[model samples]
Target: MQENKNEKPFIPTLGITIGDMNGIGPEVIIKSVMNPKIFDLVNLVVYGHGKVLSHYKNLLGVDKFSFNQTNNAGQIRYNRLNVINCVEDIEVNPGEETKEAGALALAAIQKATEDLKEGKIDAIVTAPINKNNIQSDDFKFPGHTEYFTEAFGAHESLMFLCGERIRIGVATGHISIAQIKDRLNADVIRKKLELMLKSLKKDFNIGKPKIAVLGLNPHAGEDGLLGNEEIEIIQPVINEFKEKGELVFGPYPADGFFGNSSQSKFDGILAMYHDQGLIPFKTLAFEEGVNFTAGLSAVRTSPDHGTAYNIAGKGIANEQSMRSAIYMAKDVLLARRENTH
Candidate 1:
């Protein structure tokens, strides 16, 4: 589709993937789009089966909303919900893990990602997917962060979690705890810090972003008493960047950083591993957190939580995180465009 310059201001179209059908993906997607105001902000194209969405609509007792089925992005109507059906004859059994559910989830992600790459969609907001069941020959990445990093051919990507007051990014993610120590190095640390700094400037429109780096061990290695990673690895990188006039600080102990409210002093925080960052992030912003993959050629965001299998068809899933993911994707896209122009 070609851009029409004479029309009203261009609104980017966001493609949403239906995560594992047996999970809460469809429920949250339906609940999120029910708000008419969301339609005004961006055009939405849902890549999933129409029947699955209809099932959730009926189950949730939401009768007022309807979807317009279309196979092409150019045919999407900005004023109504648009769906591009990617699966059929699928059974949706809530709280159950099945091959069919995983296959359906993979199909939606592949299709939506293709559209995102082709510029048919401006950005993508994915619902949650179960990492175990959603594995396939075609979908072999550990999680969305790894999947998108390869999909967009990005040299590297940062798994950033953002909320109202806190922003945290992990240096290493979706890996075993034992592997974290081996993974901590000066080069990896430098790249993560660079990604976080650039993202804070371009994606979030923050100027001169101040970043805090957390240590790998207790009391920041207790000055080499607990571990030497802080002294041998982390501090050297921080010092290198600091001398270059970047607003970077720390190698602070993770416990005292969050306990003393030191996180409030920086624009972003970089943790050495997954649990070190997410444990405190979810504690503070579980409901409204957004998972954004920074350094990708195209923008992608997902809710900070996973597929809630236990609450899958209960119609009680909170849609706040899903909604925040959509809004964050839009904000990042807009910020990138503004920075480019």
Candidate 2:
């Protein structure tokens, strides 16, 4: 956090919504922006309860953290971290569930989403929110993607788990295991793969990306002996993409794809289900991995981990994931602007 002598706002504002208050959201964020190098890349607005963030500033030794409220929505003053605080009647207890924390987190997200739609910010990168605490009957979304889809009324969006070594995009995310077979249609897979490739090219800046498709069963259905998902569901979709000259291959077994012997075959991977992609991804790259939502009008990324409530307010929490998320958002925004020009 740096002062501009007289102080002024920075461009390409990065809107960061604090996740669950009972977790490490504020802790990691405090540690992240304390470096001041962050101000050089993007001006960050910490969307959270002002008190919680103030507590964090003291804990992290950032004596200069300050926020000046603005009358105009776009008229944000960036001194260190601009906080649009939403006060709620919640106790910030570490490793506990409470409605106050939940409501606070939701308000920040909604505000940031509106700002993104209005073009006030170039992108939004979120920290993890507690599902059990925040989810209610009215809040029907399983995660941010569902909520964003419903917000934008978009027909489809893709969830891609990104890592330095590999990236995995799901054909369908957050659905039942049994429903996956029914959902694995050629049109759906083709659409997801298309978005994945486009993301690789435009966001990731890889011109000719190679993507490997993972199978839905053991031994890749063992040529239809163990299961037919490979033959009946996956292969047809993959073959169609290959015929169109995309560098797509597989219906390969998930086990062998991430194996030490076979991990180098592709630049990215298309997984059939949740655990099929996430297990290997987290195993290899959880510390620095990022989650990006594809097909959104604006860029939204997050650290691929949840708020560690048990470690909230502790100075020892890791900032690697949050740091990676910020860098990823900047990278994507720059690439998108370049491509558009």
Candidate 3:
């Protein structure tokens, strides 16, 4: 963790967690940090198996970059990507799942977040982890978002996405469509909206961002013809939030809200559920999209794309999303800093 004293200092210790070893996390991390510009702006602290990083570096053929363990965050070069390896002596096989890799991924995130909570790192950006593997019979958990929320005792965290076009925040995420009916409540909607507004200002650099919200049912409940969630659950929240001086609007129908031409009007959109937000989000921006967890004490982000396992070792995985994730993480860190003082 020791940083180089002679070189210009990086703002925050950007701790990176190599996600599921079986997936594309390691490749993206290896490729993303190779750019000299990345190392110049942030102090990199990576969590994951050292051997896995070695394999990735060898694959990327970065001969000059080396690994060193540090006790203090003062000796590492800001120009050279610094890794505080959290795990060691683990075998890495692409496209193959194992409990050890999954275990290591969680360990890295835990270590990184613990440092962030303790003020060792200013922010954390995670690589993607395979949810299915983590939910195995032996392991009991839903996913990283839920796991981290529980680990930190965070109350009802919000999952939001960042894109080149319109940014999106979700009210209810990572839940089944069937379960969304019971999940939609005025209190939850208001809190998520409040978090979204705060994130727009603090994370996305939006000054008085106007957020367009989507209705729960098709055609925005069609004036009670289709459903009542809009009038009962949604409108109340939106009205109250507007009264609170938040720049928020809608109960806009999900169908007609998207078009290449219509995308530029809104700074952010708040969707009631996952698919409603992600369908338009992935459609509008996929390869370059970044996943950001809003409403956490620590900043966390990841590439919007999933672990493209089929293309793991082919040397063809696109680094755009990972690159975008790092950039967004830095922006959020700066925004958070500006808000504090």
After superposing candidate 2 on the true structure, give the runs of residues whose Cα lies further than 4 Å from its correct spot: 1-11, 59-73, 88-90
Which portions of model 3 show Cα errors greater than 4 Å?
1-10, 60-77, 135-140
Candidate models: Cα lDDT each = 0.92, 0.80, 0.78
**Candidate 2 worst ten-residue window by lDDT:** 64-73
Pairs of colliding residues, candidate 1? none
Q: Tens digits of per-residue lDDT for model 1 on 273-309?
A: 9999999999999999999999987999999988889
Candidate 3 lDDT by residue in tens digits, 259-314 = 43455687878899999899988987888998888888778888887767788766
Native-vs-model 1 lDDT?
Answer: 0.92
Regions of candidate 1 where Cα sits further than 4 Å from its true position: 1-7
Ranking by TM-score: 1, 2, 3
Candidate number with greatest lDDT: 1
Candidate 2 structure, TM-score to reference: 0.91
Q: Higher-TM-score candidate among 1 and 2?
A: 1
**Which of the two, 1 or 2, has more lDDT?**
1
Give the per-residue lDDT digits (tens) of candidate 2, residues 84-189: 7755444677667788888888887888888888887778888889877777765678898778777777678888888787788988789999888888877888
